[model samples]
Target: MSVFMVERDLKGISMDDLAGAQKAAIKTAAQMSDKGDKISYIRSTFAPEDGRCMCLFDGESAEQVQRLNDEAGLPYNRVVTALDLTP
Candidate 1:
C-alpha cells in the first residue's frame, strides 16, 4: 500500500473536536478494511496555531484514501500521494 496525505484546514476548531475527528478517521478506516478494502489510518499532524492538519494513511490508491476521509465525514482540502520516510 502507498501512503497518502490528507490536508485539512480546521481553523478555530477545538481540541476535543480534533480528537474526535481522529477517532472517526480510525473507525472509518477499520470499517472499510473489514469490508475488504486495503486501507488503514497511519497518523496525523495538527498545527493548532494554524489549524492545519495533515493525516496519513496507507491505501491502495489516493482515491481510496479520499473515500475513507469522505465516509468519515472528515474535511480535507486535498489528498495526495506521499512518501512516508520514517526511519
Candidate 2:
C-alpha cells in the first residue's frame, strides 16, 4: 500500500460536517478491510482560513483512496500519491 492525500475545498465548514466525514471515512476503511483490501484514514489537516483540507490515507493506490472517498460520500477535489517524510 501507499500513502495518499485527498484534497478538498470546503468553505465555512462546520464542526459537525468534519466529524461526520471522519466517521464515514472510518466506516469506509472498515468496509475495505472486510473486502480484503487494505485502506485506512490516517488524519486530516484543515485550513479553515483557506477553506481547504488535506486528508491523509493509506491504500493500495490513488484509485483505491478515491474509491473510498466516493463510497463514503466525502467531497474531494483530487487524490495524489504521497511520500511520508518524518523528521
Candidate 3:
C-alpha cells in the first residue's frame, strides 16, 4: 500500500452533477475500502457553467486505485503521484 497526494485541475461541473459524481465516488470508495484499501477525499472545487472540477485525494497507489476506478467505470483524471508506504 502507498499514500499519495493527488491534485487535479478543473473545467466544468454543475452543483447537481457534482453531487451525483460524489455519490458515485462514495460508492466507489466503499468498494475500495472493502479491500483494506480506501480513499480519503481531501477537497473538491467546481465551476458549473463550463464543466470544470478538481478533486484531491490521499490514499492508496494512484495506479492501483486507477485500476480499481476503471473497473467501476470511474477512472481518475490523472495520477498526481504514487509512492510505497508499506512497512
The most accurate candidate by TM-score is: 1
TM-score for candidate 1 = 0.97
TM-score of each: 0.97, 0.93, 0.60
| Weakest lDDT window of 10 consecutive positions for candidate 1 | 62-71
By the TM-score metric, which is better: model 1 or model 3? 1
lDDT of 3 by residue, 1-87 (tens): 444443333345446756776676667767777877767555455665655565555666677656544655543467566444436
Residue pairs with colliding backbones in model 3 are: 11-51, 11-52, 11-53, 12-51, 12-52, 13-51, 13-52
lDDT of each: 0.95, 0.90, 0.57
What is the model-wide C-alpha lDDT for candidate 1?
0.95
Candidate with better lDDT, 1 vs 3? 1
RMSD of 3: 5.4
The per-prediction CA RMSD against the true structure, in angstroms, equals 0.5, 1.0, 5.4
User: Lowest lDDT 10-mer window, candidate 2?
Assistant: 78-87
Candidate 1 residues 5-55, lDDT tens each? 999999999999999999999999999999999999999999999999999
Better of 2 and 3 by TM-score: 2
Error of 3 at 34 (Å): 1.8
